[model samples]
Target: MLLIEKPTRPLKLFSLSSNKEIAEKIAQAAGLPLGKVSSRQFSDGEIMINIEESVRGADIFIIQSTNFPVNDHLWELLIMVDACKRASAHTVNVVIPYFGYARQDRIAASREPITAKLVANMLVKAGVDRVVTLDLHTVQVQGFFDIPVDNLFTIPLFAKRYVEAGLVGSDVVVVSPKNSGIKRARSLAEYLDAPIAIIDYSQDDAQREEGYIIGDVAGKKAILIDDILNTGKTFAEAAKIVEREGATEIYAVASHGHLTKGTAEILNAAPIKEIIVTDSVKTDQALPEKLKYISASDLIGEAIVRIHNREALSPLFSYQPDENKDDA
Candidate 1:
C-alpha cells in the first residue's frame, strides 16, 4: 500500500507598519497567525523589508494603508511586494484599506500627471497579483490596474451600524456633500429607507460660494455621506448649510478618515453631532469626542477567505438601490 499525505493550505498574511491592528483582526478572523516580517528605515531615509519566514509557493496578502506619511507607507508596501515576489510566493495580494493617491485619479490642469494610474502601474510592476481596497475616491481607479481588483463597498457596514443604533427611519435624510458622492449617499438612504438630499456648492478665490440644498432636509435627521474626510472643510461647510436650511440634527460618515492639518479641530468645532469613520486608516492619536470609528475587519476577513477559496465575491458586493423609492 502506498501512503499519501495531505497538502498544506498555503495562505500567508503580513502587515506593514501603516496598520497592524486591523491586520491582526483579519488574521484572527481567518484563523491564522500574522506572518513575521521586519522593516526599518536607513539613517538617510530609505525603507528595508525582510520577510522572516519562508513563503515559497504560498498565497501572500500584505495589509497596508497609505494614509499619513504617505510616501513612507507607499514605499514600504512597494518594497514588501518586491520582496514577496522574489521570495517565490505563489501570489501577492496587496490589501490597501485606505489607498493614498486615489483622489488624484484625474488630471485637471495642463501639466498635472495622473498619479493614481502611476501608483497602479508601480504596484503591477512590483508583481502584485491582486488588489483589494475599500470605497475609493473615484471608482474608475480600478480600471487603471490590469490585475483583478476588488473594490469593496462599506455602505452595508454603515447601514448595520445605524440599524443597531436605532437611527434608521423616514425621519433621517442622507446628504451628499458634493455631486461625486450622490450614488453613495443614495445607497445609504435606500438602506435606511430614508430620503436623499444634495448640497450644491462651488469653490472660488478663498470664498465658499453659497450653496443650496436640492432636497428637503428641514426637521430631519441629516447624515452627511462622503468617501473621505481629508481637511474636513467639505463636510463642515455642508453641515453648516444643512443646519441653516433647518436640519434638526447633523451627522457625518466617511469611508476613510484621512484627518490632517487641524482637521480634528475643524470637525470638533463644526455643527455636526457626530462624525463616524471606519478603521480603514489608522487613528493612532486620541480623536475628538464627536469622532467615532467602526471596524471593517469582518468584512475584509470574509473577502480574504472567499478569494483564497476562489469563491464568488458578488454576494458581498450586493446593493439594492431600488429597494426604497420615497423621496423627501
Candidate 2:
C-alpha cells in the first residue's frame, strides 16, 4: 500500500527578537502574519518570552538566527520554544538560518571538545522538534541531531546572479579557497560551464609559499565561492595571486557573511572586484559599505513552504539565482 501524506495545516510564524526582518520575510512568503510575542530582558540579562497569541494545536515555526550575541539569541529561542510547548502548540520547528558554533564540530587536534554535538543536544533539551539551517560549513553537522534537519543552499542564488552578469559560460573560472570546498566550486563551474580553480594553502604557514591554482584562469573572470567570509584573509591572498596570474576580474561569494574584524579592509585591498554574500547571518554595524549585499530571504521563505508541505527538498540545493536581479 502506498503511504499517504497528511495535508499541511496553516502555520503560525513566530519571529524571535534575533532576526525580526528575516522572520517577517518568511511569514510574508508563507501568507501569514508574524506571531505575536513579548520579549524582554531583566536587569541581570535574563530573557523572558511571552506568546501573546494562541498557539494551541497550531503548527509553529520560530525564526531565529544565532549569530552575533550568540548566547543571548539562543536563550531567546529556547524560551520561545518553551513558551510554545507550554501553550500546547501542535509542532515546533526551529528555523535557525545560521547555526552558530558549527565550526567546532570536531577536534582535529588533541585535547579539544566537539561543541557542535553539544549544541545539538542542547537544542533537543530546549524542546526543538525540527531544525532548518543554511549552508553549514560541513554538512555532517546535521548528523549531530536526532531530530530532522533541512539544510538549504545559496548556490542557486549565486548562479543566478552570475548568469545575469553575463559570466555564466566560457572565459570564467569558479574558484574555491581550499580543496575542501572543491565540490561546491565545481558544482557552480559546471552550472556555468566554466572552468574550476582551487587554491591550496595552509592557514598556519606564513612564508607565502607556492599556492597552486587548480584550473586555468588566465585573463578570465574568477569567482571565489565559500560558505563563510570571516576575516576574508583566504580570499584576499587567493585573489591577489589569481589577479597577478591574469584573472581579469575577481568576485567573492559566500552564503554566510560573518564579516568579522578586518574582513572589509582585506577584501577592499585585495584584487577582488566584488564581494557578494547572502543575509543568512544578521548584519551588525560592522558590515562594510564597499561590499555588495544580496538578499536570499525569498529563497529561504520558499524552502520553508516546501518543508512544511513535506516535499522533497533536494531540488532546492545548489541552485543559481539570476544575476543582477533582486529576487522578489
User: Which segments of model 1 are wrong by more than 4 Å?
Assistant: 1-9, 202-208, 284-286, 318-328
What shift in Å separates residue 225 of candidate 1 from its native position after superposition? 0.6
Clashing pairs in 1: none
Worst 10 residues of 2 by lDDT: 1-10
Which one is best on TM-score? 1
Instruction: Please report the candidate that would top lDDT against the real structure.
Output: 1
Whole-model lDDT per candidate: 0.86, 0.81
Query: Residue 163: error of model 1 in Å?
Result: 2.0
Query: Over the stretch 56-113, how does candidate 2's per-residue lDDT look in tens digits?
Result: 9877888999888889998898889999999998889999888988999999899999
TM-score quality measure for candidate 1: 0.92
Show the lowest summed lDDT stretch of 10 residues, model 1. Answer: 319-328
